[model samples]
Target: MKQSRLMSLVESVANVIVGYGVAVVTQILIFPVFGLHTTLAQNLKMGAIFTIVSIARSFALRRVFEAIRMRSAK
Candidate 1:
């Protein structure tokens, strides 16, 4: 149980890191080529939005997995 909890924490942290990485990479590397202006404030707002979306997606995926597992058990 403890190991599982630790793994879950690691997964959550990894998601956050990946989310930030995507935000940074897109804003820094891709946006300019597309003629998009991403200032510091815009980056912060985008980061917050992406973080929320990522966490919600993780929870939604976890719930779907749990439901599938329960159905399989029966």
Candidate 2:
């Protein structure tokens, strides 16, 4: 049970980080279509800020759901 919980936590974190990477990559690739040009550094900096926000939001929501699940399990 403990191992499963830990494994899930690790997976959740990994998934969030990977999702952030994908989002950033997609944003960089598609931005030019809109005539929004930025240097690589600028794009990366923007991506980093949004990624951190996403990770925090994801983790917080995940914990809230887990708490509610555990509560109902009893």
Q: lDDT winner among the candidates? A: 2
Instruction: State the lDDT of candidate 1 residue by residue for 1-74, as single tens digits.
Output: 12243455568668887878788767877788999878877887888788878876776676667667768878
Which regions of candidate 1 are displaced past 4 Å?
1-10
lDDT for model 2 comes to: 0.75
Q: What TM-score, over all chains together, does every model reach?
A: 0.70, 0.76
The true-versus-predicted C-alpha distance at residue 14 of model 1, in Å, is 3.4
Tens digit of lDDT per residue, candidate 2, span 1-74?
A: 22355655676678877876787788889999999888878887887788777767766777777778888878
By TM-score, how accurate is candidate 2?
0.76
Residue 6 displacement (Å), model 2: 7.6
For all candidates in order, the CA lDDT equals 0.72, 0.75
Candidate 1 least-lDDT 10 residues: 1-10
